[model samples]
Target: MRAKRCVYVVTAVLPLFLLGPARPAPAADEPFPAGRDRFSSPAADERFPAGRDRSWPLPGRPAVLRPWAPPPTPHARGHRGVDLAAPPHSPVLAVASGRVSFAGRVAGRGVVSVDLSGTGVPPLRTTYEPVRASVREGDEVTAGRPLGTLEPTVSHCPTTCLHWGLRRGRTYLDPLTLLPPWLLHPGSPVLLPVLGVPLPPPA
Candidate 1:
């Protein structure tokens, strides 16, 4: 009888001893935040739009000629920006309201960068290349303002297109994040199932 009681007590307390105290249940109204392993979620999509009512550099939601494919290293081979399918001489518009940081030629191709302030450290700068400038450096431009005309002088694509790039400091980010109707948002989480137990049914 003593042996049986000791074994029972050990079985009951061993799990608690190993696992420690239980965590409090999350609040009913509180949002379950996305974890650091958000990329592991099966339902999580790859791309997400950045802002609401953001205009495209080219009209009519132009298809991407070349998508953003960041390289392993800065100097390695990669397409840092998306090449939007646009006709030659097509008007390139500003995607957001910001001051024109640069509007000039680089390596024989015209380039324009808008200094969008208050975004992050180094500020967010939107870039368009192979465009003949209509805006100049230090110009205050509104969203959808005409920045330049798309030129094929430096076209990377076999066909004419606009190379749209977004940079915060030295890092390049997907420019499409500026488009509205976000595909992903923080603070929304889907519960993952436990390894050995059945998942709870939807409420």
Candidate 2:
């Protein structure tokens, strides 16, 4: 009787031990090691200096300025921007992420200017004309996003291109240096070479 009771208890307890709670394996998409938080960084603010990337606004070769061309007339002052010779109606992309600060005409120049307002640095200003603007003031924009179409009627140049300008306050810096290395050919003698003119040393 005693041996039979012990055998029965062992059989009953063995099944209960074997039938422990089932734990499902974690799914493949679940992050390992349990809890983690993403998206912790502060939201991007373009106007601040820490937020902006000061690289060239567009990709590809920048339009070359003519060496012998007379400087802007006294009435017009100095050239405030560099002309990029592109075909008419070429898509114009934003240099960095920012808000559209200004978009309108400038007298006879038929100029249109877009001011980008974020990314910790000073606001970026791009000016062009005779082209339709796709963005309005306060609209947030990202780098390389299409801002508008380039129109050739404003400059009257043989080619339709963009006029890109970079500014830090009132001072103007050479826009070429701000471009990425791939856009420039290393070991090339100069950044921009004018026919018959001596080139300045690379900056």
Candidate 3:
């Protein structure tokens, strides 16, 4: 019982200990340099949009069902974000290190939003929807941390899909741009017939 209590203490305090003051917003004209990771060093990462290709397999190798289509004008009819098809109840994850800004139900769907540190004046935010949250607002999370599980209900896509949105202030941007080119354009993957099969004891 004492050991169990100690484990809980560690879990609770670790996050607080790791959380740092949010990095300062970048200058208006200085743009994010090419070839930099959005979650990399504070000096280089600022001014870029948030998220990463590291989430390529989020919730289990999700496929892009709908691409981000920016509207010609705000309030115009256009898809605001990309939608990725994944099985219901699959675990959702944060694509980069950030602080949770929101985690709860909106309307009838679950949503989670994280403010990426050092993005800009408003700070770039990444959002996910149809997710039943496991993290809470103000919680600090690292890249690839599990934030929740995909909710069973979905509406944006014909099939179950996770809607990923990213924005700075009121303007939405391409979430994929945050990724380095190599990852964004990785060539088609080689097929593997079987996976996770352990070899028999070496002889």
Candidate 4:
């Protein structure tokens, strides 16, 4: 009888040990890693308009003159910008509100770079070149403000086009995806004031 009672006690204790403690359910307000905010605001489309006559620089006419040409090869492997299908000397504009960080040539790329900060959005980095820049470093710019005229030089591309590219920190992003919706259309023409003097290249 004592053996039977000991076996029953062991069986009850064994089940309790096996059960263990109950885990607390996850809280409703708990944040998940996958849902972390990556951008301050929603990402803009790639073909966002900068100003009048200027559209998102992408494959297709007016903006990106050569739809299929690859980016110019400066070195063997440094990919920096996109080729817009615009006519030579076509007006190019700033895509976001920021200060001009750089506005000159870097390794023959007609380099015009803008640092988009304090625009109620994340900082934007863009580069365009082989064109004449209107604004300089420290110049404050609004979205769609004219930065320069796309220079008519066949030196960079076989056909005339603006090489437009964007970055955030060190990550390269497709300019067309961040462009405004209206500029995405092939027929929309964005017109705005030409703010600075045109700095044409040497004759």
Candidate 5:
């Protein structure tokens, strides 16, 4: 009887000790492991500091009414960049520091492109369209630098909006990903603890 009682206690007590304390599990949408930034990426950090090059093309950080929608293929129909709601002739700003590769007309629509060659591989480029060029080609510009003014021209949005784009060679990337967390509405991530079998109650 004594040996049997001891066996039961040992089984129960050992399980409690091994079970350890309960903690929240990692959320499904958590981007980082624990202490890292939610939108941090090593590749982005190497090119553009986390959230560094993310200024709205329009003044006052205008709302992005239409988001980026990349096409399945290069020729397929798709929205390459984000469409920020802005008034006609609104000042357009550069999202990052770079040289103006092109600041001229394309298909009757004024366009501006900044070459981000110093930042990353495949030579990234940021383009703003339907904008009257204020800076000339080969001019160096900094973040928030006035590139041009929004011009009323062709746009994917129903209303007047600045079409902001990012590209790596032939591939177009979502410009919002380059923006800071504060500029976006990626909501708080939930953390859940790793689940293990529940330990039996202590005898």
Candidate 6:
């Protein structure tokens, strides 16, 4: 698929304001350990630091309608990523700084893939699907930069939604692991003194 290379220089920057409110993620097409809740943090997610480099892929951090459920084998039936509830044409932003590796279609659905900078070896690549891309392949994009808008078409969910995926080479992982707690599990918006607000006790 040799398409023309196009560059997109983003002039307008978006503030990290999303952490709005998304419905709690629900386990889809699989069963979890009997005692655990669907949203329970897995051990793999504990290693990630709450770094500033990451941001929500969508405004308001849309509801994760379908959580990642990996298959025992690659060819088995399972969701490779997550399905986030979104409206048609909502902007889909980058989760981190990266170069757009591929911005095209797959199985009749628009898709975008980004190879993240600084991640070791085969760099972590984030993917967004059912999106009509505004940025083209090889373009460098910053976190929160618009990659495209969710296409107004049939979605895997009952309503329109965006499929968000992340991978390191051939391995699949939870996309939510990239988000910091504040953005992944934000409380109601609040205002406090920036100078010297009292800190909450250490967890």
Identify the leading candidate in terms of lDDT. 6
TM match of model 3 to true structure? 0.64
Order the candidates by TM-score, highest first — what do you get? Answer: 6, 5, 3, 1, 4, 2
* Better lDDT candidate (3, 6): 6
Estimate the lDDT of model 4: 0.57
Q: Whole-model Cα lDDT per candidate?
A: 0.68, 0.49, 0.68, 0.57, 0.70, 0.75
Best-performing candidate as measured by TM-score: 6
Residue 10 shift from truth in candidate 2, angstroms: 84
Residue-level lDDT of model 3, residues 1-203, one tens digit each, is: 66666665566556654654463332232133233223222232334543352554274456677766544443344566677888898888887778999999999999999987766678889999989999999999877889999888756678988888777766567665555544555565443333343433423
* Model 2 local distance difference test score: 0.49
Give the alpha carbon lDDT tens digit for every residue of 41-72 in model 6.
23543334457877788997688778887655
Quote each prediction's TM-score: 0.63, 0.50, 0.64, 0.53, 0.64, 0.69
Candidate 6: residue pairs that collide: none
Candidate 3 pairs with clashing backbones: none
The digit string of per-residue lDDT tens for model 2 on 147-191 reads 777765644445665666554444343334334444444343332
Candidate 5 local lDDT, 1-203, one digit each (tens): 66666665576556543653453321222122233112222243333556455666777768766666544333444556777898888999988788999999998889999986466666678899899999999999887889989997544567988988887666567676666766654455443343453544544
Give per-model CA RMSD. Answer: 15.4, 27.4, 17.6, 25.1, 12.6, 15.9
- In the range 1-203, model 1's lDDT, one tens digit per residue, is 66666665566556543543343332232122333211111122233324553578987678776666544443445555777888899999988888899999999999999977456557778899889999989999877889999996544777888988876665567676666533213244444332443333433
Indicate the TM-score of model 5. 0.64
Q: TM-score winner between 1 and 6, please give it.
A: 6
Instruction: Give the per-residue Cα lDDT of candidate 5 at 8.
Output: 57
Candidate 5 residue-wise lDDT at 20: 33
Of candidates 5 and 4, the better by TM-score? 5
Clashing pairs in 1: 50-177
**Considering summed lDDT, which 10 consecutive residues are worst modelled in model 3?**
33-42
